[model samples]
Target: MVNVGAKMDERMEINILDYRLKVMSIAKPAIERFTHALIDVLFFKSYLSGGCANNQHGFVSVTETDADYSVIVEEEAYKAFEGKSQDVKVNEQTWLPLVASTGPAMVVQNAAGISKIANSVVIPLADRGISVYPLSTYKTDYVLIQEADFDKVCEVLAQNFRITREGHLQSSEIVVEPTRVQKALPSGAGNSRALTHTFDCSDTNTYCMTSMDSKSLEPHGLAIIKALLYSGHQSEVQTSYFFNLSIIEQDISLILNVTLLNKFPAHLFFDNSEYWRLITIGDMPEGVGFRQAGIVAQISEPIASADISEYYISSFYYGHAFVPFDQFDEVRRLLIKKQNSQKAAAAAKLSNGL
Candidate 1:
């Protein structure tokens, strides 16, 4: 067990602990097939019909929206389209179809969502003078690159993001998957409506957030964990509360409150030290204080295991170190500073009427 002592000297920016992680990519054959490309972002009054789904077979990728649909299709797919028949008729309204030239496309499947891998892949391409037109899907991130530039794009992504042909993290480690339950809030935190929802991790399981095993987590479970880790404190009422409350309920409780509270909402009294530990320390305090130390240990003690650490780092937008080991206390303090600085900036922005 590590004791994170009170106030450490302020430090400068900390880089993400280089995990030497390997990512997966698929771009070669995609580049070989298509030099000319057409990307279509469709707008409809409602969800596209089954016909649209069937018609998009050879597309680079297709994403559906409540009001519209978007797709990146190979030239062959567009070429096969009988232009007039492509129009989707919805409620007696017709949406005309138009195709425009775009770059060759490839997809990156990451369990951690966009923020986790965006900087890893995107910035490097920007530095290498590669322009990327990205489209996001529920399960993957797609980018359109020119066939001419595919080689450079592939090289950059492969080198920096460790993209492999598999297009996903291929690892054999077993991990306990997290299960999510959406339930109505006992009391609305902010703008959430009376009958509106909050997400709770129903499982009392814990897993390593930073180790190679992280790659083996179920995609959705990894996504939810990443959501908790990568979450930043927003200034808005709804979004901010959602982030805070989620961390308290999911990452802190689901991962920590194993024996204490086996249920969704605990019955601990406010006066109890355990209760204060959850709200004040375990929740990631806004300011630095000695009283807030040992938070990582408190949450991690019950589930401590050799395969997984009591500590894990969040390699999200500006990484936050959550390790409970003394060796990483410096990194943890840096995270605290970063969070405080962000909150301070938000407060200043609000006060300045921005």
Candidate 2:
């Protein structure tokens, strides 16, 4: 573990280890293909947040829309009927024609919940054209190609997507002791009947202040406050918000917990967009240049890649070295050794100078 003073040397300024990563962009044709574009035709929504039932398996969207693909293929089949031996074709016994099971039929639905039957089902549909993909009875509309056409499509899309290696700042949890937190907070902050909470998680909006007048909360602020209370915090009386959104309203649903325990509430608020959802606290710290660090050491060990994400140091801090927890002890030991080696090298230089 890293000691509080590890490599400190009184270094408080944020040490950013920046690196450049390359990202592949789609070409004009690919862009025109409209990858990851939402159809919103089916509008398949559930009350749940996420799980395997919600998220993807190996590769969920391996479709023509992928930058890794180019062409698309489709097929349509017809049944053949034969005549009976007698002059009267079906007088004796009628015969039925069977269609090939190469691919199954699917349905397509529009925004109005109106449905249409499609000729065939597209597993991962094409990027363009009228197509239908089956997810049980509720079919999603999209441009589709046949699985038999996979190779041709992928050949066109291959390498259209390039990989970029970007440097990142690390993330670390700051477990503030309630005592220390209490000291940090202004007095009279905790003695509040009305809670002022920013209706958004991102701190880019107005701070929330108290509202003693009992009022119905919009659905927006409901979930997080419930979490705070359900965490079993002493919320005999707490503030709330309801974030019921309208199609026309542009307000964001991201509310933040900004109310002080008792004093006037302070925090930022904004509609939670994609960028806000995928950021770290360090990315938007409460104050200027706030950083958190932890220390660990291993006497003798090798590196492991499985636990890199757990080592939350912003990439800005650790360079390209994604130190995993299993190997973190090794890193500490190696760092200590590197320091000793560097000092020895310096001393040798000085001795030679002497």
Candidate 3:
């Protein structure tokens, strides 16, 4: 077993990806209309073009749950969805992606390590009232911040983290201001109501999280791409409701319904045995732009407190958390406890105000 604590203490590196991304969601019923558009982003040469000056690296992520489909793509790629349907909801904010890693590689086998990495970055940002949308891959975790918050995010996290910019011909280090001091939240702060009422656990399907080398695409890309096309068509039949394909520069991580694993060869992935349950955080009210602070911390803190292994993916409209199958009930229990605690704290504060 790897020493997770020791690993956590290692010097952290965060790469700021140079892409202006937009988050979009499609209602399950409207997914059919976006099938070709989705296919194009995933497979076509035109959509694969990088978002930077070198045109070598770009990012695209698509996630579906029982509630809706969430997509993260370059601002240019978002044109495909324009005027497509009233069912599609798009956030107008432009987001920047920051990829976080500690060592040569992040080992996904250690549950504690994953939670520790998430909490280190998320909790600090949350404390200072900065909103963050976090996504986890097999290799590392991504923190997506609104472009407006980038400067403050740098100010808050610069003390402990080594920040840099990537996706250009030469990488540049982000200079941290030494005189800036971090702020702490007062007792009983933040959006407690949003934390308490915005989440629900999906009891319908169990999922498997797996990954393949980006190089694998060289030989099996066509077959896997065909499977995705078929899966989109199968959406009408409703055999599965959750699938996530996250293609970073060197890694491709997939979260798929266990029932649908047969679509791809077992040998193509690293390990196909782990099972996870879904907890979906409903979309913020329209125009909210995913900027409310402490949402990720509120959901992740309780689970991590229990030492449970969890993964989070924040889409434009929703936030998704996956816990081990056996631990699902326990996670739900922890969340309810946290919700009640927030409610009680809110009530006590109101009484004091009275």
Candidate 4:
């Protein structure tokens, strides 16, 4: 829905996992033993439907330290292993369980440098809410993501990256809009010391305010204020400042028109230069006497400017507003085209030994 244009790339779906899985950490000194357990469960026990196809084989992350080697496997696989061998001690925990996309994901073998993929491919996808897990190889770096999310992944990579079931490179043009809400703030807020101003809207009584100066307002704050003023689509929001101050009872009732402070949970509007974000979790039902906007929360990541390649993306702020959900097909089309373009560029660089 973001007007990405007509040139859409081809999307291919692959087999992936269905249900969520619990993590089973197997501490075994011999890696071969763990491999044998999985082989036995798959070949002899036949707990899985078939070999990797249809995602019968789930995600397994193994970490090898000097003291111990741990093999974290899927829940179903662990159960099958337990059925086969009762003596093995398996620790089951919910620490960051691997969740793969539904159906077979088209795996792309990108013969590109890790740093290049990190900056060019991974960072862009992450910004668009598409997660790509890069599996490293001797010459080619394999990029894995759920087939369902591949279109969006490809769209984010469009123009600068490429993807092929067979390792071939392609190219395209890409347009990047880095900010969320582009609309300028009201002229009244132009003054630095301004506190609050009420805008005339056709529907609701909207009051816009800044706890601090206009310069202190980050992209996150501006986006929230804009969304509150206008009817737009906002999915997720992230910020670095937290609010704990309490508001007086009468002011809370007058402002939000709710009796229970917990129901209306008022947070102090500070003018301090800090990062703040309001995330629209879900649609609010009719007649629930509260602000239509979603939860307002903040984080601790400092407000700073740094390039994605120069440093870690910890302090970066990227927000999306007015994303067109109705025009999904068009969005996907633009995404795929951009992905091919990126791939072509990367391939060209690799061929020239860049």
Candidate 5:
């Protein structure tokens, strides 16, 4: 628990939804006051277990006064935070001496000019080339600074501006190395054709859980891609979520329309019984095959969006009627008019100015 009061300028705003982090002077007495202050605020009775003990950092737990409070004294944050070294603020003139650490970085244009000051040295996490923003973005939570210039930069930060503890923050970390395997628009995603499933979910090959390392699952994958590529496809997918699982008509695994269990049929990758089979408007499985029409496909977001540091995300080459999920219908209608518009919108910026 902590015991300190804070005052901020009316214009400054920092909103951390669930976790609360308030910073006070990182000194000895100030630390004590801050700890008690936290205690006083957190004194309410928690319906369930509450209290802190030693943690990964070997810090002592907070001392609770309430007899009913969870005996496991809430671990005191100040324990570790106390007597710890603080990061001196950094500036642009500073050289990032070390290989930049990978993580989410907050680019806050607290006032206006700080970004400019930081830009001479600090760079947004994803940008590789020369583009820069005054209200530019940041690559890591911490600023990039030369260890030698650290003190000089901090002086400028503390004196000239206060970093807003809030803003549009983007993270460049992802669990999966999202990969996209290109395939013919009218065809399925990339995968070794050798592996095959019991039921070919493809337009040509019917197989379930095929050993084939297929990216798009033909006919089945097409349905999903159809919904994903186009916007209005949400209903098709939303409705499909219900059929995620239903009583099976065939001992032979069959996919079922999550919504219209009676209509569309294909083997589901996930068990609907456990109820985890909802289709996302964004993702489509690879290795599935479909009727070829020489059309192209594209991704909705950037390749970097996958948190991938490398990999050039190219525009889908599929020549089909490509329409964003939002303009699916308009694009679909355009297709009806015999226009070779699989997708009118560029998934990402493509080689062509289209």
Candidate 6:
């Protein structure tokens, strides 16, 4: 059994960001109406004014899946979607982002590191009934929770680990007393026992995960933005299975389909040579909303157990895991085997009527 508290202490350093964020989804067909506004947030409006030390204010992420586009933006940047709520499905509740890093000296070059971090932070929170939306970039992991749950979350986690807020306004560490006993992580703690969902790989597309320092964008930001704007007009690009652009603070990350990636110059990104394949987890049933927990842990744990590296993104509607193109076959086989074993065990239990 894994010691959840010890694992977290060794692997993660977390901060509760000050930004109030919003998660919204728009159908692919309707995204055109707000293209310009989205561009401005990505390029100009998202950046914070002054040297406020927390100039990391402009946070915007747009994730495209087969069904729709999920947009996560800072509350201020959300003004672009105002008055057009009818066209977009916006979650009325505000959310706060918790940034988890592996420290400055450590670099997460594989999915195993990501998996460990997810297991440590996400699993414990899920076990306690906290529903978190997780987003991963090349350099960092973000777990977003409803603003209303902030204090409760801090209290729960502070018992096992120290909690601190990021940004200039609230840089102080959260003061809390340890009230609960730390325990080993339960085996299969994050399994999707209550919901029926299947995992499948994308048949038509492969993806590339890459990123650039936000400052690097200064040289070719407009050209790159224009390329993205024009690429959206292409029917092929519109229908692609997965594409993501996330800008948080000084980090800019992208998960683009090979076809869409061709639109940008090679010099714009690092690690552009590597390719990834997507494993799309079936969407949660209607009415589940984001209340469902451990979805990430279920998928990530299996892959991580196999020592396979994976990048995960959970949008408003669906969850996606991207594995290295060369290792996709192995990862798929492992998941299928795990699935079969679970099914067999389940059938035997049903037969015994236990």
Q: Assess every candidate by TM-score.
A: 0.24, 0.18, 0.81, 0.27, 0.16, 0.84
lDDT against the true structure, per candidate, is 0.25, 0.20, 0.70, 0.28, 0.21, 0.71
Whole-model lDDT for model 2 versus the true structure?
0.20
Span of ten consecutive residues with least summed lDDT in model 1 = 241-250
Candidate 6's residue-wise lDDT over 279-325, tens digit each?
87765444236766666666776677666777888777777888888
What would the per-residue lDDT of candidate 2 be over residues 34-65, giving only the tens digit for each residue? 32121110011121233223321111111111
lDDT of 1 by residue, 196-227 (tens): 11111222222221111222223333333333
**What count of clashes does model 2 give?**
52
lDDT of 1 at 119: 37
Higher lDDT: candidate 3 or 5?
3
Name the runs in model 1 displaced over 4 angstroms: 1-69, 82-111, 161-354
Residue by residue across 1-354, what tens digits does model 4's lDDT show?
242322323332211223223323233334345565644432232445664333323443332211122233445656655634433444332222111111112222321123324433444444444433332221232344544554455455443322323211332233334232122223222222111111111111111212322232232333323322221222322111111110111111011101111232135333322111211111212211112111100100000111111111100011111112232234334334444665787799999995
Off by over 4 Å in 2: 1-326
Tell me how many residue pairs clash in candidate 6: 2
Candidate order by decreasing lDDT: 6, 3, 4, 1, 5, 2
The candidate, 4 or 5, that scores higher on TM-score is 4
Shift of residue 5 alpha carbon in model 5, Å: 24
Number of clashing pairs per prediction, in order:
4, 52, 0, 23, 75, 2
Sort all candidates by TM-score, best to worst: 6, 3, 4, 1, 2, 5
Prediction 1 global C-alpha lDDT: 0.25
**What range of 10 consecutive residues in model 6 has the weakest lDDT sum?**
104-113
